[model samples]
Target: MLHSRETYQPSPSFTQPEMITIILLYLLIALLASVVGSMAGLGGGIIIKPLLDFFNDYDLPTIGVLSAATVLAMATVSLIKLRISKVAIDRKNGFIIAFGSILGGFIGKWIFNFFVLEIGLEQLIGKIQASVLAILLLIIFIYIKFQKNMVTYQMKNKLGILLAGVLLGLIAAFLGIGGGPLNMALLIFFFSMDAKQASINSIYIIFFSQLSSLILVGTTTGFGSYDLSIIWYMILGGSIGGLIGSIFVQKLTSRRIERIFNIVIVIMILINIYNVVKG
Candidate 1:
């Protein structure tokens, strides 16, 4: 499951030169992944997991840690931009969902550490993860394309927002994803939020949830000893991508960006499924 030259601890068999090459690759992938994910409001989950799976021997919990680290950086950048841009967010709704997601993320970390580890549940979880990715990709594509006319939110959909928060939070914990995609979709489709507002609010929501997730995972999961440099590179690359994506988004239609995002997601998910099935 880990790379031969384990990222957390380099193997004696591999030279430093080889490790540097791997790190460079990781950086490149991070840039591309974040650009696609941030543009689409999916919080980078669709790409991060599969990329990690293919490149290293990271366990799920470690992936969770890395994911949290990267998302934290992106969220911080996004939050600062939103503040400067004076983007208005429905804080009442954003906070409520964030509260649920934060709690759910902690619970998720606990489940991953205690139950999944104790029962050796990685195999089952892997299969389920692959399946979920496939379904999510398909749904994202359909929602982005055909649902344009139907995609609208009602002011009265308060109950739906609460429900979405809890559900997405649970999923975030289990998958090490930021849960922004689902929440943003809900806000866009059910709350009548514009693209910019949804994006800004998602930044805050994901930030808090990831912070809470890190606390739980750190307390119980022990960091899995992955290379700290990988975390840094991922965050750095993701930040750069987020800045570019946010700027490009201001002048573009949501539908256009969504179409491009869906294509990348579908390809990644298909590759992920193929890997899981092969394994």
Candidate 2:
């Protein structure tokens, strides 16, 4: 069993060089993941969460917190870039969705705590998360592959949009993924947005949802037991990656973005599958 949150500390056995190497690795992962995630509207947590789980360096809660913080940074930077570029967002729907996401974030965190602290099934929860993520990724892959044949709606109902946001936030928070591809997929299907549009709006949604989730974590558990030394490195990487990705998104065609999104989905599915089996 993992140590309690009050007692757990990052392992201190690594030599100075080893610690530096690990920090560099963390930065690289955050950079790469954020770049691709920003381009594809994934918020990067989808990639970061699984990779961190694979590393087996920290407990699940710490990993979730770190991933959330990193993605929040990426989303914030990406959205700022978009705003500066004068990219228009659907403010009415966006704010409604964001509000719903805040509610869902709280509920999801509560559920996660229940499973980990009350049920005492940390390992089981990890495996379950991996398995579910893999399955969801597979479903998304198939949907995207055949989305050309699918019928999409341009929904304008405020209640429906709010509910959709809540669902997206709940899934993203519960899975510790920043609701990247899933957000894009929902936007495409429900909002009838094209690839580039979905990517931009998805980042907007991610910023609000991740920000709310992190606020909840900070005000409650306060990141006391986690190894937060590497967080600054990851945030820096995420910010740089977001800048690079925003530039690319502006240059790339929607078709190109969709292609990149498809490739990312495939890789994420494979990684989640590996995590599930390894667990």
Candidate 3:
């Protein structure tokens, strides 16, 4: 159901060298996204989607598929590396949120297929996604800016965490992201978790969320709907980047990563705005 490379057909416009170069570019981007996403407790989609949009002419569904593949690779490799390095994954709470995220992914993908794909509402959906994401990212930035560390203020609210995961999963699937910004925000600001730990847990949450998304998209979009071969390039980069990022995560501080994360979000919002207006 996933990684169906059989459907890939490189376009006639590119020669062999050109195709290899483009694939290399995709790999590089995925690698960078995974590295940053891992350090910041995100699943790396926010970075991947816009860069993919800026560099290529692929449609949203194709982007969604590629984005899912990238996130899956990042999550898998990062989780493995972290586990081997003895990083705590917070299996208790992380799994609670992940389960909810899985359910939400199906719901999100159903909406995407039926409303956006089937009805051909790409423009409308894109606009809505851009607008909502811009607003949310801004809110997250402001919220984090003012909050002092209440690191020990424990939130054992299972229901709340689950609901948050559902929301994150739905948004991730709909927007073709790994819910990095949102997930990191949830862990760092609301739950009072440390940045490094939150980042690790964020990948865990994203792993299951993206898995559900790929399965759901495969069912709805069918095989060969997009160039499946491109996913291999992205996955390779994401895997390597994931392992690299996990190894370096302990050396960095959350505050520094948070600042960089917000900057990236602002830039992404600007890109989204430009796309919306240019449309």
Whole-model lDDT values for every prediction: 0.68, 0.85, 0.77
Model 1 residue 145 lDDT score: 56
Candidate 3: regions farther than 4 A off: 1-18, 149-153
Answer with 2 or 3, whichever has the higher lDDT. Answer: 2
TM-score of each: 0.85, 0.95, 0.89
* Model 2: residue 218 alpha-carbon error in angstroms: 1.1
- Estimate, for each residue in 148-213, the C-alpha lDDT of model 1 and write its tens digit: 577475755566666667777878777767876666676777677655556667777887888888
Off by over 4 Å in 2: 1-13
C-alpha lDDT of candidate 3 relative to the true structure: 0.77
Q: Residue-pair clashes per candidate, as listed?
A: 4, 1, 2
Error of model 1, residue 109, in angstroms: 2.6
Over the full model, what C-alpha lDDT does candidate 2 score relative to the true structure?
0.85
Candidate 3 residue 63 C-alpha distance from true site, Å: 0.4
lDDT tens readout by residue for model 3, 48-157: 88777666546667788888888898889888888888877789888988988888888887787666655667768777767777777778767666656334345688
